[model samples]
Target: MRPNHSPEYVQSDNSLDVAPPYFFPNVDVQGFVIEADLKAVQKYCDDFLNLGTREERGFEYRAVPAWPFAQLLFLHYPVMISAAPDVVKGGNGRDSENPIPSSNPDFIVPMADRGTTSQNEVFAAIPVMRYGVGPKGLLVESELEWILPFIVVDQPWSCVCGREMLGLGKMMSRIDIGPGYLPGSFLGEVHMPGWDGNSPEMQHDLPFLYVQTGPALPTFRATEPLKSLATAFQAKPVRWALEKIAGLSNFVDDASLGLVPTTMQTVALKQYRDAVDPECAVYQALVGCRSKYSEISNLDFYDERDIWVMFNYVGSFREAVDVILGDELKKPLVVYPELDKTVSITGRMAKVVGAFKFSANVDFDDMRVLHEFDIRKDRKEGGHGQVLKRGSSDLTARWFRPLKGFFGPRPMP
Candidate 1:
């Protein structure tokens, strides 16, 4: 992956050089540990707690990856500094083989303005780099040179082939949060203090590490029923009023659709929680009916044009149920879907829904499950597996694992 910022406007499509979100490379129980391994997770989190900001710019810790790694710049020498937050992998930068020198070195995918397909923006293949040693290799070393007290960092990066990525620098830190974006200020050309208007060659240096903080939007990823379930808990009086109208036949039957309490740390809405436990209510209604989605979106995409965005805001439960249950549960609903990252909320079960067992449903046609993780204690242990009976919104029942995952997937090396 490359740093999300650019040296100049013509050089990259990055208008938002804001700090990269620390949440890149998201991790979950059955997912890969982004960048460093488990050891790094605790270390990085601890670093922010102990030495991070509120004092000077240093290790800033946040619930998501958007603020710290993506924003703060790290200094190395007197001439250059590192790019905060790196961009998703792909895209041959201007200096790189954009309209690649070619498979034939002359075969360019012309742009429409330049007389070619509009969607066919010529791009060369970007080489993928792996850490090599860790479970999934992470960046271990790189330099950030200080160009001045306030200007942006300027330098190049060297790839495994010894070819220099002219404008690229080493990514000091890389990570992904559950589902959050970093501020735009950290990634753009840094504000170089004391930078002469037309100076030729000048430089300065200062202490490196920096940190910042912001609110943590902690939410979970569930199907339409799950979110609709969360909605059911919006207002106590409304919920209570609806329940009376719901009656026995009206409720959706599932194993447990209630609030996955473990998922609520920084619940975005207190009013919803205080009013109802839609998570539990919804889960129970959907029990035996369907629990999760069918096929899951593959989290890893090797290019900028493709991605596995997280679906955090599963539609509202109360509204859905209101429609399913009747006029008694009338309430306005909102759609809350996350546009990035993967997430898992433990203790996932529906109260009034159906009483079903969780199971891993892999297919002989797809071996990705085995390739992604090792099999361990089945769904019984509650490791990483599918809870049977996916909802209508969840793709199809086919989107589950055939076998349970005892541990998370290790990131790419």
Candidate 2:
């Protein structure tokens, strides 16, 4: 065998960036639950998260609409930072002094004067169905899995690191949030670089997304310490009521399915476009990641009547939003009454099912490759779309070895 390469030696001089096991110590989140059209959600899952055929196993990943709604969440980090502990102790062949770039604070955005403004992001979480065949040839659906189709972040470093490292497809945008636009409420807008006309010369920053929190009704704030935002909104009665409104009361279980609790589990499509052929992908994969929150406090719920969420049909962003949510700008379920003469809502506003806010210590870790797409042929055209099977499970004993004893006998190698 050839001599093992030194960890201190740069793996690739062309790409010298942060390595994974990323962590975020502080994260403030504001979430809004929107009742979405079921058909739209289904189409999105089929188009993006569809797991193609495996000729040998005779089993493939499939997506069905779990719930007819989406979660629009805004995350603002007060002291945004990243660290790579694996490289610091010289575990991966690198010396302690020659650590990865992430050993230093790769991205640091100090809290603004008013708080929650330095690093901001807005994303939509529409849970797609993940099912597999069981031993008895029965389909078992995993409700905990979902796909994140849309996300925009302000920090450039965050955008690069998130996409390259964790497979978080984050776009660069100017995200503004917090009070001032609406009294006793929060307002958020995502300004992305796009064109007003048909040419690149017209490209400029345009606010295509708008979300405003109306003042909540005199609801009591839960002071008790909580685990996550999902737990805070885990009231069965409320969830069941919302499900009933969506005509899913009969199909869903009262205990689960309606409102997923804590540790948000999600999947993302990570891909790199070919340098020679922009249409073809060099590498593509479906990555599974979990966002677990701890030390959650100051959880407060809002009356649905008080929250407003809307998306614009910009030519650039419509392909992404409309493919999932339908023609939002032209078609709308409810039209807001003419309150401000200047403001005209051409796009659609989602029916707010639930709204909440909380503070927590979030960790953006726990990620692994769930599936990888064959990039030889174009997947979009329905060609060579099989998933590459892994030879063995990707687990290291140093971490999970202790827990193995707690379980039954280990599997024979």
Judged by TM-score, which candidate is best?
2
Give the per-residue lDDT of model 1 (tens digit) for 296-402: 21111111111121111122212211111222312232222221223322111111210111111111111011001122223235344553422221111121222
Error of 1 at 35 (Å): 17
Candidate 1 wrongly placed segments (more than 4 Å): 1-42, 46-52, 57-413
**lDDT minimum window of 10 residues, candidate 2:** 108-117
Question: 351-406 in candidate 2: lDDT tens per residue?
Answer: 67777665667766767766666554455575654543222122222234466656
TM-score of each: 0.15, 0.69
Task: Please report, in order, the local distance difference test score of every candidate based on alpha carbons.
Answer: 0.20, 0.58
**Once model 2 is optimally superposed onto the true structure by TM-score, how far is the C-alpha of residue 250 displaced, in angstroms?**
24
Clashing pairs in 2: 329-347
Where is model 2 more than 4 Å wrong at Cα?
1-16, 54-66, 86-118, 134-143, 180-183, 196-201, 219-261, 328-345, 377-413
In Å, residue 123's CA in model 2 sits off its true spot by 0.4
How does model 2 fare in lDDT? 0.58
